[model samples]
Target: MHSTIFSLLVLKVSSGSAMKLRSRFQPEAVGSYRRLLCSLAASTHSVEESSMKSTITKKSIKSEILRSKSPTRSPIAVLQDWIKSGHKVTISELRFISLQLQKSKRYHHALEIMKWMEAQKGFQISSADHATRIELILKVQGLTEAEEYFSQIRGTANQKAASLPLLHGYVKERAVEKAESLMMKLNELGLLVSPHPFNEMMKLYMATSQYDKVPAVIMQMKQNRIPTNILSFNLWMNACGEVSGVAAVEAIYREIMNNGNVEVGWSTLCTLANVYVKAGLVEKAVLVLKNAEKKLNTSKHLGYFFLITMYVSINNKEGVIRVWEACKSVSGRMTCGNYMCMLSCLVKLGDLVEAEKVFVEWESNCKNYDVRVSNVLLAAYVRNGLMEKAEAFHVYVLEKGGCPNYKTWEILMEGWVRSQDMEKAIDAMKKSFAMMKGCHWRPSEAILMSIVEYYEKHGNFQHANHLIRMIHHFGLASLPLYKVLLRMHINAQRPAFNILKMMVKDKIEMNGETSACFSSLCKRESARE
Candidate 1:
């Protein structure tokens, strides 16, 4: 009977195609049909042979999808190509591909896969699939489209599951009014059984600086007879510290200890320690952190990161060193993030000697050459006015295969500007601009003004004009840029009319200094005529 049922499900999955099954059953089964197929794939010899063939096909499809350099390539096109090549495309394989893309932060590709699945003739998208699609939409298309998609699924089974991601999107965006309306609706629909929704509300409140509302959210959770989890208590404790004081936060911690409903972990202890530190209770904070250390899960690096950071907050150098050594003693090799955290903490304490030691250790053991890790040390060097060391390290990083990101160039540009190496600074600025293309990074106004001042001081008309054009390209044109440009053009005996026209086009109101520069330019041009 089981064999017959499995065969029927497998047939349904294959769409009754006589073509050879070229896709292996994914280990994680999403629905009943896939689950039955997975179990049967493991039992029989003929099934095992088919599964092996399927594994190769799945690998081929995944490799093809991931190998495409263009993010805009259609996943549906890839799927169709596989189908044309005699490879059977299963829903589970599509889901697995979508999940892999999501894990790679390729939201556009993942959404394309979700859209392809939706267009399939016979396949039914479940409520859970709708929820996943809503989240992908939120990521790729933004909140408005996600809300529109949510509205279309209303009054259906997908509505309830789909509402959670929409609520989360509102919370993430800090849309207080919309979030409250959705929470009330969820409550009315009796979908507020778990503490997850309440926790989200509390998180939103905390983010908006309305700490007083956090406890109210916790109360609502209790009133609904929902059990508070570790995260709920953690947020509640943080809110208490903000609204009330250390006394109130400690009271919440005591209640958690006595209630025994939620399992207390290192995170809760870390929160309590943080409150204690903020209240200037250093000794108490240290005691709590020691206990947190006792409960710390050594397998996870985040716990050690928190401990090291808290120790740095207290200026407990000994404690920092202890935690660093403990993290190193863990079984697996330390991650790049772990090394970055340690280097950051050491640098914060102004212990460059130890920071250099940790940086060297990271370079020796790191599998991937992450410039961010090198950036921590580079920033420390630049901060200390060690220009020689900073320049040397920058060259060494390039030689060692470290690609300088925007932050790296920004740091070097600042240092060069400080040291009055205008040529080097300008070169660094251009590199930083190139790296910032397709991203949202912008040079700080202070840095831009410094470069503008450099041009004005030297009367470099050509470069100043070029720099202003670059600034305009970045949508960062301002009165200062126009003022400098007018001064340079007037000094160069060029027509200042175009500069004045640009000012008008940019809608920059002429201030006192700008009017003076404009008047000077007009007088110069009049005399030249």
Candidate 2:
């Protein structure tokens, strides 16, 4: 009896011939099947509605956060408003928002979202979320704080997952000792079940120039029966290239091709090609690059950029143009990064005309003006001693509503300094300093010294004093600057006592030249008295 009902249901669903099923089955069975069909249809509609709602919710939340006036604005406030507006916040939505923030490099905002999630009642934060929060804390705060947070949750079931980010942080900082100690601890805890931790250790070893240790890492992986990933093989190939040569890299490549567990990727082939290029085996490099091109994922631009860079390194202009055209063909509308890469390669190859054409294409299609894109051409102009063109391009950028970044002013300052236009150089330098204030950037000592020499030669005491104060404000004051100041004071027959006091305060050591300058000033003062 049950089989008869099941057959009737299948016939109704497959053939949708309800009259035939009705003729075979009892009226009661047909009525039950109708109810089931209604239930299934409702369930599918409900799922589609939920999916649509989820997509809309994600878009709304992302827009709210991105539209905030400042990066420091609390994302929690956005969530509160979202909740107050008769909307529910799901864990999935919050996680989605956090991931988006992370991709945009807004770590502080991402951390705020994580904190909000932890505070919510009945929301079970997964181990992966905890790991993400730890990584965000490492970025927003420091490694010390991240380590402290990890210590509190070190004994949890998913401690292995939580610890990987910390290990990555250590590798990023090149803290070899801490990384090795953590690896030892993880091994003792039996948490080294995957290739991630081992790959990170290999990366650390390579970064610290301990190339010989890379093979030991691979051997350990083998002994532990941990399968290697694409990154593992790439790093191994690079370390081999660094330590041994092209032969060693090729051997590893052959092994990778044979290892069914690992899929040979475009990036792996690119790494091998790079090794070949370094060894001056252009023919071999070209062959590997062709293989890499075959493996290229058409959706991604990274491989194309890497190929262009390799071609540039080998002075293969035709190869660059071919890959570039291929990239454009695949990507109907190119990105700013794509244009910049092509422009830079063309400029490097002394194909300024082609560079200009590419720049114009970017300018025409770009929604918002990116000064960096223009800066490439501006720099090329300045680098080749075309100051007039550089100056004109700088004005053109301003006219096009492009804001100059620190690098723009830096290039202009360097060009002006080279032309011995001290006044313009000083102006550009001041602008550069202003742009670089509170940033990690510092002007090169060579440029600073050149400006100092200019000031000293012209006996420009006022500007020299201002420059010294600016340098001191930026914590860039050096012995050379103080020495130049002392000489200027001595030459101007002004009192050098205050300058001497500043040197003492700054703990600038008195070298032979400095001492001699001070002595000359002292003797002249005595004569005047």
Candidate 3:
């Protein structure tokens, strides 16, 4: 027992030696070392438990998103369910879901997510949040409601967040007058306005070929003491390169390059190259592109693609291939967008085999599969007159659990029609109408024409009527579609008076197609007489 006690004392002395630094406060220490260890273990367990709970929350949120049938309604319902269940949804979580919705082009449902956040208890949304909501409204609603929303909420937010989004919307709609007036109104309010809005307006003018006004916009920026960003300067340089020559371009470039406050951007260099190209200075353009190439970030697929695009503009196929090879050498996380860009380039180059390989690589890896990517290949096949191949590939895609959208079926219909297979085209149309749920999913003119011709030849007025009724039911309007139905009825010697009445009730205007169909009806009646 003496020996055991001596050994225990030795161990205690060793441990005590390790604790010498804390010895000064030992009298004030609240717990023994064992108790302190227990507290630390408990703390670690609590952290692990919180981590597990967070994982579960994320899973529940995802599952909720997957549970709802409608994209437009799903997010809203899930958010409401969370609130009702006393689950705390973080802003980051909300933004993540909103980002997914935005990427999927589901603006209405994204808006619903924002709406839920706004309605949350004791939540004060930033101007940025309100601006995001405005952007969503612009997309799902329209310019009018977006403007109304901006005007109604201006008193509560900063000018940048409130007005800039609307200005962007106007730029999209090409509403020059409205954008200018809004800018003027913002100026009158004496708010802190940035050069970015003016830059956007200037680009709009440049796109519309109003080169003279670009300088005025730049002058306004200078007058306002707004720090002109590289992008705006690039736009100005592009416009001024023709009128101001290489000297002016070089002077400003040097100024921007020397300014310690200003950082030179790749896009700025690209714009400089574009200006050189416009001024008949191919060598100068090549030099600018070389400088851009030197600054090219290999990890960014878009940068390489942009370079490839510019090379294509210069008609430099070899340069494009070299840049593409460089892009392939980069080690990084390749996104869906990168795959899409590669596919697009390959398709443009008629490298179908390469495209398919690139496509398969993405197809195996991508979780959120978009049918549009598949359609690009489908259209490629159809354009090459490989209808059978297109159909077979489409079937393969569907069997592989691909989400076949309306455009997918539309491409199928178009391929059949292009091959003059009216029977198959009509069948495709029937399938399209059966599944048509929204305005964006309407069949093309070529698809509709194939159906109408098939109906006219088959004299199946019943089927034609059904097809027309379905098209209008989905809110897809086309004068040609209506005219074809009328013509088919007239040719079938069936009473299309009811069809005409339906058109009148639906307020279908009589265009050239409708008028020609009516003229055909008159000729048929006279012949019968």
Candidate 4:
């Protein structure tokens, strides 16, 4: 038998498949095989003194088998022969083969061998006995097939607590539905239930956005008398925040507060604030965010950033200020985002004087200003009818970085018009147009109209007409912007005939404003002609 086992091992080693060459015999398998060989060798000994020589011979055979690179014998046949000869091979040896087969992704073969081992005398395979082996199978193959095999032993009266990886497997497969059903089945049959499985199932429900099902899953856990932990509560809160909106989130908060043992953390408050913001309840969002800061004993820098944004969305000036103060408190120096928020909010509220003050404050602290912050301050300047300040800051940004961004140029152009500085405004617009030309970015029709309006506002018809020519040159003549120039001519009360001639020259379309303006300009122009 030993000689045949040796020959088989040699054959397997020499002509083995790629799979065999790559096989990593695990330590457990090696240890178990060694133990089996020792047990088989021990069985060859006799109680009589002279029979010790036979024991030594058996040890020599076992040693030879161990030293051989591949098994020369059929391990299963050798084990069966030992059992038939009335010697017991350890169950560990059977498990080693099962694991090896499973490791090779040969699940069907592994399962078959497992069944054969179970049918053997004194060969009871406990789930606890094979948890590690089964976990290996699950990792190598996958949860779906692993769970099918698990189910065969999982609900048996002899089964221990379900494995952790199996619980995680349910989550990975997004099979919370199956987990919920199976957990209940396990409990109904008086099986030892594990809380991890229920927790994982709840997590799975959370991942799939089926938050509505979480309460039912939690109830299932409760029915099974499994203790809920912090993770369970957080996932429940997250689910509520998703489907139930702020009201549900508030209820979750109340429950957490009532639980004296579990103090609320910063993340909980952040979540509450987020839900409140989503629900469009800005006041409630700010209030909850503030309370969260107090409760967590943390600064409100991050919270204030979100708070200010919500307020800005609703045009809540006072709320914006409050949030800004909180932000400043958190970070002593204002960030660019905070500065932009302040500038934008002040401009929208029509507090031009305050806006001017902020612009100057930003410049005085120029050493601390980020280039983006400087750009926003320029926009604020332009919006507030402060062209000179806008130009200075635009230059500042260019000196600090490169040229001002598109927004900076746009704001400056708008500011130039507001301050009745046409030539500089037109020059700025032309420069912006040139820059766009360089970058393969074109000014929209609206920008051209803004420039035309600037010229018309300053009563510079020739320059406005020149801009009209430029608009046509850029193939923007068919656009609606030329109408603004026609309207400007009529509003200027220029010679109406001359304005009409200009319109005819440009083929400008006439809308109500343009027609009326053109008629007015024509009456004046006809009198002059």
**How far out, in Å, is residue 132 in model 3?**
6.7
lDDT of 2 by residue, 432-453 (tens): 8987766787888778889998
Residue-wise lDDT of candidate 1 within 342-368, one digit each (tens)?
999999999999999999989989888
Candidate with the larger TM-score of 3 and 4: 3
Candidate with more favorable, higher lDDT: 3 or 4: 3
Q: Whole-model lDDT for model 1 versus the true structure?
A: 0.77
lDDT of 3 by residue, 439-502 (tens): 3566776667677767767788888788777766666646777777887777677666766776
Q: List the candidates' TM-scores in order.
A: 0.83, 0.80, 0.66, 0.39
- The C-alpha stretches of model 2 lying farther than 4 A from their native spots are 1-123, 154-156, 526-529
lDDT comparing candidate 2 with the true structure: 0.77
C-alpha RMSD (angstroms) for model 4: 23.6
- Per-model RMSD to reference: 12.3, 16.6, 20.0, 23.6
Q: Number of backbone collisions per candidate, in order?
A: 3, 0, 0, 13
Weakest ten-residue segment in model 2 by summed lDDT: 17-26
lDDT of each: 0.77, 0.77, 0.68, 0.56
